[model samples]
Target: MFLAMRAAVEETLAATLDRLGYPTDDLGIEQPPDDIDAVLASSAAFRLAGEAGAPPPKVAAEIADAFDAADCQYIDRVDTQGPYLNFWPSEQYFEHVLETGQDDDYGALPDRETSVVVEHTSANPTGPVHVGRARNPIIGDAVANLLDYAGYDVERHYYVNDAGRQIATFTWAYETFDESELPEPERESPEYEMVRYYRKANTYLEDEADEAEIEAAEAEIQSIMQGLEAGDEAAYERVSEVVDTVLDGMYATLKRLPATFDEFVKETRFMRDGSTDDVIERLKETEYAVYDEDAWQLDLPDIDKNLVFVRGDGTSLYTTRDLAHHEWKFDNFDEAVTVLGEDHELQARQLKSALEILGNDTDRLQTVHYSWVTLPEGGMSTREGTGVDLDDLLDEAIARAREEVEDRLDDRIRDDDLTEDDIDRIAHQVGIGAVRYDIVSKQPTKGITFEWERALDFEAQSAPYVQYVHARASGILAEATDGEGINADQAVTELDSRALDTPSERELLRQIARFPAVIETAADDLHPHAVATYTREFAEAFNAFYRECPVLDAPADKQGARLALVVAARQTIGNALDVLGIEAPDSM
Candidate 1:
């Protein structure tokens, strides 16, 4: 309803401006500020005041005077406040909002014909994921969820860096290092267990290995890289076994956070299938290609630095292989989104420039660059073994969440005879939700200092708070209908907007009405934090309504209306949480 109303207001504004001989380039339709007593506002009057040779207040009044709200079903009236043109929603609009908000699929947009592929979390397969790099998968998953909710055909991908030097180093460590050499005790998971070998090997090379021994290790790693690139069956099989084992453990960790990939693409595939060579050959023919210093390079006009595609030894760089992968993505999907860390900003720009020089459409690709998630103590380094592993963080979060859940549900556990498994399940949900929310609720460009208190806080703008609101709404509906055979759906049919007469009721209704608009905007802008912000506000609005207005205790005629409101609020909150890839529990 908010989107529809905004559209009507924009259309009316455009027509009015054109009639008044003013420019309509900027519609300036936006939600009014908190102090404004309007549903929507347009600042186009201010934008056009310069051209009209008049003050903004006069221009706004002129536009408001000439505005036509007769044909708009959702707009109540248009008025001018200083330099702003504010719109109010009609009673019919309120009724339509509540009526439509009751649908199970209230927040999803209509399906689009476009297909999108989201590639993210392509961490090196050398060790376990740490909390510092946890933002990648969390943001990637939520953005994919937002795109899916916005009706795009979305596919999630994890690009395995199997052809890189890091994989060779890990494979060498796997074959060379002894279990006793591990710094810590062996872990049950392969990612955790094998990382010990890699760390020990790195430490030995860094702190104890002689020059001759270091040279031998380097030679072996080069041999492994060449063998993998040349498709040697023995080397390929050995590396594949280790990579798969590590990825298995990594996937287990991701599953706990509920992030999954539709595909795992190996970088070696491009090397073996002649795709990388094809890319090099194509670049060699381009006007920008430069063969200098025994290396193949592209001196792009717009890029400050030259991109080297081939080294002196004739081995292709990761950037060259990435070109092949992006080409394949362009060939397969209508659009593509790649999530990268802030360090990759230049590479992302270079990739687009290279693609454009190759005559492929670079406009179809989007890149989201996010800052790192550092610990409160400091940043993390996997090679140095001085970071908090994601598995351990998750374990700690689950333990803490269990303590919190026990505090809230102790009486219910005793009275309702809840099983241990039930508590475990709820704790897992809350813990994972808290972790995912902590990473995704901030703007991607800003770094986050992950703190346990902020992530798991029950009273603040955390996932637990939103989840609790959902559970509370569910409880209200359940109690009102317990043994009465009056479900929320039945209350929906008799819902009347006029019955909800209080200011708090109207405010909550307006907030609920904004869900669809929020989804559309967030998806278009690739900002999942916007969804998080809207969900928190929605939760607060519902709480306000709960306090100021009673559902079960209302007058008989208004009781059903308020219950219908609860039903809509519950579904809206659930939908918002789902977009953030967080679970909505029915019970606290």
Candidate 2:
């Protein structure tokens, strides 16, 4: 079934035909028509027959004879009808390839330390994470996993914005609440509860609020940020204390969902090390910086926006500090990408140009804007503390999913048997899988409105469906009395091509063959959903095949072949799911 390997086989065929004097260099290969008996059809010899003053039928027969004598074992029959050469997979090869992926790297690229540092899950340290930040790590982790599988040196990192004014509000609000009095259960999640603390602080400030206090508070926050950036030991210690309190709670939930980072780049460190200050002076020397209103701005005339670099008060703009950070990444790796929300479009461009202004290499710095559309909640704001906490959503998902699983199994077991901790882990897997699947399944540019049912459903094109399929395969493999686990012999077939004439079986073969190609395209485009979509399609095909062709009770040869097909399909779907940051559970 090398012909099922499609493109590569076509090129190989074209070269052979060309050497055999087919009077055509346009010899191409294609899959058979949707319902056709042949695996593929070629038109080159037929198309050039008239020019060569020969009958196309006779020319096609000659080409078919050449292929028949070749190394490929799949094509059993080659027939010419007018200007076409059609080849059908020999039954043996077709069934053999079904149980195994072809012998190629499956388009896996090599790692020469060609690294990508992905900065993701940079939720502002003001409150707990929510669906808004959910897609960030889902997408980031998926991309990271895909890059690693494709042989890239990928380091996942988080640029924690703990030094910003947002943290000041988080700290100021927590102090207002004296949250120490809260019950242990509530106190366990200081980050999530900080929203209430923020609300109390805002209510108190509302009575005495004015532009002066607002500006004064803004200045104090900026001062804190600068001190943290400037490596002021006292400021670092103070801010880290408050930030860590919330960060600890936040990290606990993030770890539960498994959003990890190789490094945590503190925004304060970017300033404290004088990197931003150094970048600004460098920009000034290159005339990229201009003094306006006693504030230095990075001139972006070509893009028609004068980006503020350093304020009139001599503090760095977000863009200036970001420039220093990117420079740091460029020094460390050959490439770096960012998984940011769509709101950062302008910021991305400004950051890149500012890097250019600072005389840093921007070409090797690859930036990916892994954007997600926010649901209609007026977006996350640190002051109001209104967006839903991701932990809450995860907690709810875990409870619901565990209930669903229990309902399906051990109907008589007491609820006590499912301990809170047991339900927590089960929920963590299904809940996070649901959240991750919902985002990864959608197109990156589509804006989403949060819907609970859509995130958790097993019948829909969601994580549950794919995970169930994997579990199904595991179930079948478990039932086997220690048959040789799927190995290279999936390439050996006991079934015939005529047996695969049915539409569903053909579709399964088509999808299995396209696995390598689909991944190659996805990796090149950095579109994780490509893999997501493929997983669904393959699963659908398998389901269809299952309904039509019973696997477990078939004849010995047929059952074994079907099991091989199951193994291939399961492995492929698992690989695709991994690239989308979804897990394949052994049991539903």
- TM-score for each model: 0.96, 0.80
lDDT of each: 0.88, 0.68
Q: Any idea what lDDT model 2 has?
A: 0.68
Q: Which stretches of candidate 1 lie over 4 Å from their true place?
A: 183-186, 409-414, 417-419, 483-487
lDDT of 1: 0.88
Best by lDDT: 1
lDDT (tens digit, per residue) of candidate 1 on 498-570? 8988888988899889999999999999999999999889888888998999887778778778888888899
lDDT of 2 by residue, 1-588 (tens): 342445544765676677776544577565556556565678777576776678887777777767642455455566766667776555665565564543334434446568778887777766666666777877777777777766778899888776665666655556445766433333357676655665655665676568887676666666676676567887788777777776777778777666777887877777877787788888888766778888887777466777888777666776777888889899888788787778887888888887876667787765556555365555754455556667766777777787766666563433534455655555567777877787887877677765657777777787777677787776666655344433324324533434555677777776776666666567667777888888887888878987887666655555656666666666767777777767777555
| Candidate 1, position 272, lDDT | 85
Per-residue lDDT of 400 in model 2: 78
The alpha-carbon deviation from the true structure for residue 439 of candidate 1, after best TM-score superposition, in angstroms, is: 1.5
